[model samples]
Every structure is written in structure tokens, then in C-alpha cells.
Target: MRQDTEVRTFRDGPSPATRRRVLAGGALAAGLGGVGAAASEARTAEVGGVRHGTVRADGVDVFYREAGRPDAPVFLLLHGFANSSFYFRHLMPRLADRFRLIAPDLPSFGFTVVPDDRGYVYDFASLSRTVGAFVDALGLRRYLLYTFDYGAPVGWDLALAHPERIAGIVSQNGNAYLEGLGEAAWAPLRAYWAKPNAAAVESIRARMTLDGVKAPYFHGVPDPSVIEPESYTLDAAILARPGNADRQVTLKLDYKRNLERYPLIQAYFRERRPKLLAVWGRNDLFFIPPGAEAFRRDIPDARVRFLDTGHFALETNGDDIAREIRDFF
Candidate 1:
């Protein structure tokens, strides 16, 4: 389904003119009525062709955003840290006509709810299991996996477990190589991994603030003004939930496990030889450009494309990335 590549607003209440004016004035924070208001509005109903729903999976309520026809080839979009399926709000609609897009909020992020009694472990392996349960509950037998940030480890885990289920992979700033680790930006995480002391944990927790949430979105973008403020604002609001900070800290510590699994993931790449596409943000400080280039070492035919954006490439280059996926697939 082709969509007009004009400035479009996702909310139902705002007129196009009013939305444009509000965006121009840089008052979206006020117009969005803070985090509570923005998240509440998003939860109320579907916007554009995207529909929101929840399914019980592995004792956790897995919330997801879905679009496109039920029978279309599946595109399982797994988001990164501090983000939910909401991150795909723009890109899903753009590709809904061609692919069945399903972006699920992992157990800890977004709208997914974990009961206090469930005692869910906030680690990559557990998260991958929950996502596997989610996929089974949805009856998705085969799909094209889209991995970013934290999603890389989870998606790779799935691929390693059930190699027959994945049709292909699209890695957007999803690093699987040690060389891809950006030492400067990852100092705090590395420090936490080295020592899970109070100071180390506090350093990682400090990034849960509003400014820290905004950092990845603004870091390498040539024009920060084009970024929608609601993106980070909503993430900050979600991170502020009670007990959420500790959950994130736990995940940060467990990230070392993902690093350890890099060799195994590379083996999967060589043996399975799944169709792969790496669309990277050249300026991403967390996952460098070499991460994208490394995919070619295992699968010589893998396609890699770099966009002049920051960590969140879809935020700035959604249309271009969408076009690339359509052409490559």
C-alpha cells in the first residue's frame, strides 16, 4: 500500500493544520500532555492501519502492534532497549500493504504486563523464551525477523533454536560482533557488567532520565529538529514506572551474555546462511558501522546499507529504509 510521503500525524484528535502548527512551535511536549497523556492516547485505539492487541504468552501479557493482511508474509519487528513496538509506529503503516508487520513489546518494555507473582527474569534468554512463546501463541510459523539493539540477542537466540522458522533477517544497528561495541558510549554498561556495585548500577540508572532517553535519538542525527519529541518522552515516562529502573539495570548486566554468544551467532550465519540485510545508522554511537559490515564475513551475499542517522535510524529514514526492504526482499 503506497502512502503519501507527506508530514502525517498519528493521533486522531489533531487536525493536520493544527498538528503542523504545534510541531512547528516545538510545543509537542505540552500538546502531548506529558507522558501519561501520550501513552494513554496511544492505548485508546488503533491509528492508521495498525491495530493494538495483547495475548497471553508464557504467563506474561504480550502487547503488540499489528498491521497488513493476516495471510501476508510475516515481518516480526523486535525493538531495542527503552523502546516498545511503538517505535515502529511510522514504519509499520508504510510497509503494511506488502508485509504482515507484527511488533511486540518485550516482557519488560512497552505495554507488556508481567504479574508480580510471575517472578520473571529480566535477562536475554528469558526474554527470548517469552518472545518464542509469543510467536507460537500467534501461530506464526515462519517470518522475516527485524532486530535492533536488545532485539538482536533475542532474535538471534530464536534463530539458533529454530533455524527453519526464520525466512530472513534485517539488522538495524543490531550488533553481533565485538568490534561493533562502541567503548565510549558503552562505558557505563561495561562498568556495570564488570562490577554490579551500587555506584555502577547507579551510573546505569542515571540514563533512565528524560535527557538520557533523548540521547540516542539526537546523538548523530544531522538535524535534531526533525525528530518527534514524543518518541523519547514516551520512553522516559515508561522507564519511570515503579521497579522499571531495576529491571533495565538487570538487563544491562546480562548484556555481557549476548557478547559471549557472538561466536555462536556467527556460526549460525555461516551454517544456516539465511538471507540477511543490514541497514545501519552510520553515526550510531552504541553499535558502530563495522557491526553492519561484519555480516558479510559469514554470508558473502548479505546486503549492507548505511543511513546518515543516529541509533534510531527509522525515526529519520523510515521511508528510505522501507524502500530498501521492498527492493532487497
Candidate 2:
């Protein structure tokens, strides 16, 4: 086995020159809009009509992307670290036709506003509670949960808190297994958690740049030209907001709490046996295939698929993932 620190470092990312090239190039063929004008118009005409809103939930102004018809089955999309509801921009448009897609930018991430009073904790437990308040604020009785990366813990906690409210679960590179957090990939964060000194903080912050944000989308893809550079560029700008970096590192250090609850999360899966569909990226270096396969251990009927992509599978296989979700529901 590779030593804990032997995993590759993300410190070295694409330079500014490369990002400038991508933005100026034809790689953004799709742009932020969908395929063609007709398709884009049709997508916008979907039920919820891709509305953006902010609601006061648990003392924070939680920003969310609401699309599809309210009467349709609810599909709650929870994003991961270094990103916000914007992560689901591509998938939301596609699924909005059938399901009620709601993607929120958690506090301290996107446009969501968290007060400086320090009244709330930044750990997963508190974040999970905030998510619960957001769900209840929207009166979501039962909804499909789409969890990715950081979303896994929050969604799982929500399921545990209110089992009757869950319609099903869709996991994309979400981790519920210990083995999913490969040591090499987590070394820096682990170091931070252990020491939490200035040096440790600097180690993790080094990759919080624009290039680091862009790396995940095209990490293992064969064709890097397909993904739009604007995706990460926008996210990087959000992370650069005042005090957001410290909040992110605090969350990263608190991730150990999520791992501690993994057993309870698995117990819920085995006992409650919620319908599960894991659309994973096989090339994901963090949450590896074993984490996706672990779903089968509890829910025998779980549908698991390993895609030919990286952590952000939707960047390359959004259409495929969307189709699978539609069929699964």
C-alpha cells in the first residue's frame, strides 16, 4: 500500500496561461447555454423555468437554483466542496423537464450569506441541520437526493433524520465508505486536521486557486476541450470572497466527523434500504470505485454505474448521468 503521504499532490495545477487559452479557444462550444438556440429555449421553458431565489433558512440567506414543476417529484441536488449550486448548472437544465430540481449554494460557498456573529458551527452536523431547515423551509415532504462529494454526508444525515421524507438517492462520486478516501488524495487535509498550523493551512490553500478549481472537471477526461472554462473560473471567484477560504478549510478539517458517522450512514442504508443509483466516475482519484460498489452491500437492488471520467463526471457525462437518473426514477 502507498504511504499516507505518497498520494499525488494537487499543488501544481494549470497555469494562468493555460486557463487564458481555454477561455479564448473553441472548447466552450456549448458555452453556459445548452446545445443550440432551440434547445436552450426549450430548456428554459421547462417547468420551474430555472428560477433563482434566496430564502432565510437557519439565519442564513441560502441561495438556490429552482427548476422543473413544483408538482413533479422533487430532485434535491447538493453540491460538494469548492463549488456551489452552480455545479449542477448542466444537469439541472436537463432534469428540470421531469423532476423538480433544487440545487442550493450552502452557506459560505456561493451567494449564500452567513453572518459574522459566529452563531453557527461549520461542521457537517450543523451543516446537515442547515440543510434540513432549508428542506423544511421549502416544504419538501419527499424528494430524491442527489449527493456528490461533500453532499454525501449532508444528504445521508438528512435521510437519517427523516427517513420517511426520502424518495430515493442518486450518488455521483459520493463517499459512504472509508476506503473511498484514498490516503494520497486526503494527505494534505489530513495534515491540516492533525496540525492546523499556518503551514498546514497554506498547504491546503495553495490549490484553492483558479487552476486548482479547474483541475477536477477535466482531470481524467480524454478530451479537455469539451468542458467550459467559465465553470471553475466563476467558482474560484466565489471562493475568493472574504472569509470563505477560512470557512472551507474549517470544513475540510471537520470532514473527519463525517467519516466517524459512516457506520451509522451504512446502517441506515442496510435497514431502511432506500432506492439507490450510483453514477460514479471510475477515474475519480478521491472517492474511488470501491465506494460506489459499497452501495450494493446494503441495498441489493441498487443500480451502480462507473463512468469513464473523473470527479466531476457530469462535466463529461452529464447527458448519460441525466438519462440514468430519469430512468432510475
Candidate 3:
């Protein structure tokens, strides 16, 4: 049950379990802070063009937007850390015309609620676990996995573990191995995952922004208005929660540790070797083109499109992205 990008730790408040720790002096990141931006775009979710709302999942209620025939090919869309299913709302229906588009609010984001007081472990492991459960709960044993940003790792793990269950994959700006920019969390999290400080913590928080969200979408596109500010706002709000900054810092720290499990991720690709459609924001300031090349290294049949967008490929390239999914299938 993550919105955890790279990190995977801290459940039941704090768990004594197996993990890796990279650097030191990064834990002091208790302080972090957002944009007025535009309101969230109006997204209409319909089932066969019939308006639909939320869907239920075990131990958590998932608010999702779906459309098209249930019998059609299934396309499951997932967003990044601090992002909700809303990013797909604008794109899912159009794709639903050809396939059953399912986009859900992952555990801690969007309309999905988590009691901060109870301390749900929001990390990559939980994300990977719950996504597999979500498929079983919905009786979707076979479907295309659409992943972006943090969704990459979660979906990758799923595809690796259950290759037969995955029909295909839509890789949109999701991290594969250590492909993204070695930013604040990348180094510090890896270096000081177990032991951290506010200074190192502050560096991680500095990267969050509406512009950062929009930058990726602008990569190949000729227009900038395509960016929806509210989506960035949603991401920013999650960081605003009390102790969230620390949680993010801790999680990122954990993600670096999780990085040590790289051999597993790489081996999964070799073992499963599923067809991957790589849709990327070439100009993505975060996970740039070098990262895009990494996908090709593992999956030989990878078909890549460097969109003029950033991490949220569903926004600017929604129509084309959906079409690409159809082509891959």
C-alpha cells in the first residue's frame, strides 16, 4: 500500500526487519514544504460511456475510473508517488473505447484514505504487494500493466513475479533499475538510508514541484498548457501531512536500500522477457533519456516513444499513448 517511490520501510510505526542502508546524515529531513496552481481538471469516468465512480478493494477502498466493456482487453494504469488516479481520468475513457481502462487511487493518494495515526507502511514492497492483490480482487489474472514514475518499480516487480499473468506492459517514465537522475534522494538515500539528518532530508523535499510534474509532459510536445496544476497540487499536499516529509525521507532512504535488490529486477526481465512499450518524456528533467536507454538493455523487443512530456505521459500524450497501448496489444 504505497505511494512509496524508492523507499520501502516503517510499518506498525517502525518494524525491525531485513533491509539495506546506503548513506549517513540524510535523516534530518523532517522539514519540507507548494503551488496555488490550477484546479484539478474535470475528468469523466464512464463504464461503457456510463458514468462510474469508486471501486472497492480489500482493507482499503480504491476510488477508480473505468470505462469500456469488461470483456475487452484490460489496461491497468498506475501513477507515481504522491500522485492519484486522477492523472489517468482524462486518458482512460478514450483508451477505454478500445480496451477496458482501469485506473485506481493507490493506497495513500487520491480519494483513498490512510490513517496516518495508525502508520501504514507506505513503501515499494507494499505497493508491489497490493497491486498484485488488486488484480486478484478484480479477477483480472491477465492485463496490460501501465506504470509511470514509482509505478515502474511496482509493476516491474509484479511482471517479474507473475510473467504469465501480464499480457503486456506500458512503461511511461517509470524507473527501471537506477535510470532516473541521481538527485537528492538518489545519493543521500543510498548513502545514509538508515541514518539521516534534516539537511539531507531537506534536499529530497526540494525536488517536489508543479513545474517538475509538468516538465516531463512538455518534453516532446509543442504546448505547455496541457499540464494540469491540480495534479501537482495533489502530490504536494501528500508531502504537507505531518511527519510526511520525514516519512518520504525515510522511504526514499529505504528505496536506495531496495536498490540493492537490483539483481532481482534485472533477472526478472531476463526470466519473464515480456513485451514492453516504452513511452517517455525525452526532456524529462528527472528521469531523462539516458534512463530511457536502460529499458532497451533489458527488454529486446521494447518499442520506445520519447514523448514531448515528462513523468505523467497520460496527460499530454494521452490519446497517442492509448493508441500505442492498442498497437502493442
Candidate 4:
């Protein structure tokens, strides 16, 4: 999961077509702003307790974990690449008393199911579209976005599409800066983007095994035993599903699209300057700590802290993260 955290700027400037699309999207976003704000005002009561359920949205059965008061300020948790909403199991209960937590399994991951019609693109853009629909289906008008790993792109995409809906952002090793892409770890991905052949596919899928599932969770923890076994066990089971490995490979190949959008994502931060809090695992090989510090460039007041953990910081610092989130939100 390691990446080269060197700043890279692709595409000198937006093409004429890109400019037109951005203008059109801006108009649409302005029109939709009031819709979410009004909805938030209506659902102001706190929810009762933690629960699990599924909602049919965007042609997928989206599974999610919910806790805290229905009327409490909402916190939308977006998990990383190898894990689902389950990754937030420990952190969710910790803050349930103060916040309304909604953590969903993105399409092609976790318990969420998508039909086999090949209609779903499984790329970041398509996943982002599905998440937007998922949020609408759940009637979540506004919330703080907690994004990690893969969730970073998805959450940012949603924010850009519906800026009015984002109350703030909490980035935990969720990289948006190009300098955060460390080359050594990103070799396989870079190879895939360049060649995209069977060998490249194999390189991307190499980590789909059990060892790979366990690697990130324990990467930098002083006492690996502190990380629950169930975390990797559940993720490995999901990865072993029929066609799941291939689906993941497809997503990995599509990661380049996210890199392409990095500039635009940064632009959103510079322009909108949403309230940002970044809690990073300093020892993380993937999305290294520098990525967290980079947030301040776009958001002067962004609060960034480094935890002594790995990619899955929650595995080692769940209590601290929960506390930080509670105080901040």
C-alpha cells in the first residue's frame, strides 16, 4: 500500500470541455444547496442506539452500521480499501453517545451486493455516484465526512458534487496530495496503469491473500496483539469471494483516474476551504504522514496530528481518534 508522496501536477490546465462541465456542475450544485440545508433542519432529533441494516439504492443493496441519536450531528464514516464499514466497529460505539454514525460498505466491497449485469463500472467515479445516491436514500442531508484510504477519493468526489452537504472533513491517512504517493509502494499500481496486462493485474491482486489483509492493520503497531483478529479475518473472507479478487484488481487499475482528479480535489479544498481535521498514522507506509501535513497548504486552519500506528490507525488508536472526533465535532 506504500506510495510515493511526491507532488505531481498533471494536465497543465482544464480543457475547454472540462471548463464547461465545471461551470454546469457549479450551477447544479448551487441549486441543490438549499435542499440539504432544509432537510437537515427537519431531522434534528437524535437517534436511539447502534444498529445494522441495508437500503436498496443505485441498483445495489447497501449495508451500513448506524449508531448515536438520529437528531445528533451526523458523522459519515468512509472505510479503506481492504475493509468495509466493519473497520469502524470499535470507533463507532466509542462516539455513539454524541454523534450519529453512518458507515456504509461501498459497492463491490463488504456485504453490499451488486447485480452481475456488468452495468456497474466499479471505478471511483461510479462508486462516488453510487455513494451520492446512497446518502440521498438514507436522507442524510449534511454530515462530517471521515474518509480513509479509498474512502478519500469517494468522499472528496461527493463533497465536490454536493459541497453544501459537507459540514466538515476528517481525513485519516486519506490522501489527496500527489506528494503523498510514495513510488516504492505504488510500483505495482504504476505498472498496471502503464501496461495493464495480465502481469500487472497479478501484481495488483498479489495482496488479495490473507497475509496481505493482515499487513496494513499491524504494519506499525508496537504490540500487534492489540489489533483484533476478527478485522483481518472478516476482510479475508470477503476478499476470497467468487470474482471478488478480480473486482478489486479492476478497481486498482481504475485508481489512476483518482490521481488524475487530484488537482481538482485540491482545488475544491483551496476554494471551499472546508473545516478539516487530519489524524494520521505516522508509521503508515501507505499515505504517509506527510500527506496529512499537506492539508494545511489548502486549509490554513486544518488540524493535523500523527498517531503512532499504521494504515488502519483505528486498530491501534481507536480511543484517541474517537476522543479527538468527539471534541472536534
Candidate 5:
């Protein structure tokens, strides 16, 4: 059993090297429109000492970013809505020296290519299965999980399915409690959920635009100027793909399924008692701070820390988050 440790707060700005790599990656992605040639360049660039590649998993070309020594303890990073492994560009390099970090872009979100003939369903279960296959393809028997936004449910599904494989979990705004659902932030989604009609679809569809993609990054952030345009720009470009918007809509609806399984996830936390570190952005418009606090309900020892940022916490607080992970683990 891991020994208990006091939580230490870190407030340093991202290192110059980390900033340069992030800007370089954003520039490359923005220049290449965030996919196809851009992804190709990322595969070979080794930006920020991180390597990008793809592996065949569940019949999809899963694009992922990897760093750190191969023999070190693995940290599988699962991203959330409208973002990809690109979101981890800063956090990866910071911890690469100490732990093996792998961040994969899920289907419909990042550079992962899903063939038209595969007839993929953009739901949580299907998404989880693909990630599971990706894990199998990599032969990862045990590893820690770093889940954010949509990643929370996906990681929870993996843990529930194979409790033995998960060494611990680092949930960064990855919600698993009912109270975590911020009513106002999720109003649009809730309206759609209540009535899956054309109007409801249109309401959620508004979020697919470039401005919509940028909203979360600025919300709850202390200094909006610090947030980079490349991050949301890349997300917007990929989301503008021919069929990706509709797939995103399908995913929004399927999120209800994740909420339904909250009890089961909490039960896992109670029974398995996996080491949990909930580092949250208190001002997040979507998943609120209570969600982080709720983790302690099931696992009393679960560490819950809140940052002064919003939904995309890493955009403004990458250094602090990386430090917390290092100290906690």
C-alpha cells in the first residue's frame, strides 16, 4: 500500500522549453490544418522530446503521443470532448523524465482515422472498447490512468472491466459524480437530452463552431490571453471534417449513458480503492469542484485539489498539474 502524503501546491509558470514546444506544435498543426499532413509531420517531428505514431487497434488507426523511458511506469492519458492528445503537448514533456506517458486521440476527436466502412458507433461503450484494444495492442498489463473531461467515463469503464490493470487514477476534471454536472454549463446538452428533436440537435450543433471550440478554454481562466489559439484552432479544424460533427452529436447523446453508470463507478472506487488524485479546476463551467470533492465520498483517502482555472485546466495550469502528479504518485 502506498503511504499517505500531504498535498503540496505548486504555482510556477510553464518552463520556457515547454512553452516553445507547445507553440511549435500549435504552429505546425495550425499550418497543416491539424490533420493529414500535420499528423504526418507530428509522427516524425519528436516535438518536445515526445514521439507521435499510430497503431492498428479495433480496426482504427489510433494516433498517440508517447514519451519517457519504455521501462518506467506507464501513464495512459485519455482526452475529452473537442480535444485530442494534442492537449497534452505541454504536460507530457514535464513528466516524461520520470514516467512513461501515452496520450491517444480517441475516434471522432483527434487524428485517429476511422474508416467509413467500419460503421463505428460514437458512444461510450464503443469508445471504451477501442481504447481497450489499443491497450492490448500495446501489451500494457498495468498502468496509471490520467483522465480528463470525456476521458473520465472511458477510464472508469476500463477500470470497471479490468480492475487489476489499473495501478491508480489521476482525474483532471474527469467527473464521476452527479453533483459534478454543472447545470448551467450543461444546459444545452440537457435540453438535447430531454428532447432529441431537430431544435435540440441544432442547439448542441452550435458548439461545433470555432467559437464554440474556444469557449471552454477561456471560461474560468484567470488570464484569457495565456490560452493559445492553436489549441482550439486544431480542434475546430478536425471537428469541421465532413462527418465528424454528426459523430460528435451522437457522442453528446451517449454521454447520458455514462451518467447512468456513476453508481457502478463509485462502487468500484469503494471496493478496489485504487489510488485516486482529483486535480480540478474550480471555476470550470462544465464539471464543477464538487465533482472533485465527491471522490472522497467513496474512497476517503482520495486526494482532491482544486486549481484557479477552468475546464481546460492544462492551458493555464500545466506546470501546477504536472507537479501535483509527481508529488501524489
Candidate 6:
């Protein structure tokens, strides 16, 4: 039993390089217009005519990609670490045609633009509040959630805090419980949380690889030239910023903080009982399959599906995931 049990992770786990992988990307389209406005127009045209928008929160500007008419049912999408709002690019169009889709770049990541002189902290609770504020700012009465990776905690907490406003939940490769990790797999994050300093930061950054980034999903090709070089370059730039490393390490520290709050989050999901869906990249090396299993154990009546992809399953199997979310509505 001990030997067999040695193989799991999730219900667990952060770092300096960890910080870089997490907050590595933002935008300043408070109105999703002007320079962003023209881009939104092009996006709408690309996706069969949806809306483009940006929101201002805390001290940063958040750029968002939305589709469908404002009056339609709402679908709120959240992304994971080391990723910006770009994770949902392909999926947005597919669902935007049927529902009011809203995808934000969060605060420190993406083109929404972070403040030059301020220190930004990206914790689950902080991000949760950011999302909540964005939802409230848009005046969305209630909306479905599409959460992935780090997004699951942020969005889940938001839904728990505001159950009245949640329609249903669609999660892919997200964690909602404790005790889900392998020791080797979780070491770096644990170290980062313990010591979020410069050395830790550089050490973690050095291990990241193009192949490593795509290892989370179960896709057909291992080398997708589209994502590797450019994404890593963008993330490298963010890591170079002053204090940005610490902001990222703070996000890693939240793993323990979030784990402590896991029971409450599960209770919220149980008592409120929103429609929950789980999609996974069977190939994810970090947050393994058991994480999905734990979510099902608590989220009673969750619809779970697995894909042969990596961590960012949305990038590879977006259309199918988007359809699953739309069908739920």
C-alpha cells in the first residue's frame, strides 16, 4: 500500500522561479477599446461578432476577451499560472456564439498592463477578489465559470463567496482538495513557498523547458512551435522585472493558505451545489489525475471528462471543452 500510494500529488503545494512561471504575463484596456478597441473589433469579426472588453482593478488594468451579446447568458473563464487570458483564446469563440463569454488576463499577467511602480501580489484570494470585482463591475447577475489550473481555486472561491451569482462550474485540470501530490513533483513549489528569494527564483526558472510547458496535456504533438519560444520569452521578461519575482513567490505561498481553506471551499461547493464539470489533460505531470478524482468526491454529481493532452488542455482540445461548457448551459 505504501509503495502504491507513493504516486500522487495535488491536494498539495510554490517558488522564486515559481513566481516567474506564475505571474509571467497583463493589458490596459480598461474599456477594451482605443488601441484595444480596434483589436476587439478584429476579435469580434474573427469569432463571428462577439464583444471585446477590459476592466480596471486594484492598481492594474485587465484586458479581457469576450464573445456573444451582453444580454445573453454569461460564461466566465479563468486561467492557470504562467498563463494569461490567452489560454482561452480558441475556446472563447466556440462558446461565445451561444453564451456571453468573458475571459480576463488577470492583473499581473497578459497585456492588460501592470503598474510600473507598484508591487503586485497574485494570491488565490486576491485573484478571487479581482475576479469578483470584475464580475460585479460588469453587472453580471449570475454566470457559469470555466476554470483551469490555478484558476480553479480563484474561481471556486469566488463562487463560494457569491453562490447566488454562480450558474454552474466548468473546471479543467483544477484542484479542490488537499493531499494530492507527489513529493518530487511538489518539491520546488514547496521550496519557493518557504523561501521566495532570488536564488530560488533563478533555480526554478532554469528548469522550465518548452517540452515541460506542454507536458500537462495529452495532445497529439509534443512540439507545438506556436507556443514554446514566444510564450517563454514573454514570461522571461516578466520575471526580469523588479519585485515581480516576489509577487510570484507570494502566489506560491498561497498553496498552503489555500489548502487550509480547502475544506471551506468544498463545503461551499457541497452546500450550494452548483453544476460542476471536470475536464483534464491526462498527461499533466504536476496536477495529476487524482486531483480530478478528489473534485468529483466533493462536488457531487460532477460531470468529468479526460483528454489526451497536457496541462493547458484548452489550448489543444479547446473546441471540445468549449462545447462541453456550452452544452451545460
Model 2 lDDT per residue over 153-235, tens place:
99999998988778789999999998788777788877877776788777677668887778777788878898877778888
Cα lDDT tens digits for candidate 3, 35-111:
12211221122334522344334444455555544445567788876677777877766665566666767766666
How do all models score by TM-score? 0.85, 0.83, 0.75, 0.85, 0.85, 0.75
Off by over 4 Å in 4: 1-48
- What is the C-alpha local distance difference test score of candidate 3? 0.61
> What is the C-alpha lDDT profile of model 1 across 1-329, one tens digit per residue?
11112222233323444333322321222111121223333232223377666667788878887765444567899999888898999999898766667898998799988889887889999999898877776666678899999899999999999888788899999999998988898887777777667887787788899988899899999999989998999899999999998899889888899999999999999999989999999999999999999999999999999999999999999998999899988
lDDT of each: 0.80, 0.76, 0.61, 0.77, 0.81, 0.61
Worst 10 residues of 1 by lDDT: 26-35
lDDT of 5 by residue, 63-89 (tens): 888775454567899999899999999
- Per-residue lDDT of candidate 6, residues 1-329 (tens digit): 00111111111112233212112111212221121222332233323343344556555566676654343456778887667766676776677555657788766666656567545556767777766766655556567788877788788788777777777788787777655554566777677777766776565554343443434332443555534445545554655566655666567656777777778878887787778888877677667777777766777688888887767776667777877766664
Candidate 2 weakest ten by summed lDDT: 1-10
Residue 91 of model 5, lDDT score: 97
Candidate 5 Cα errors over 4 Å, as ranges: 1-48
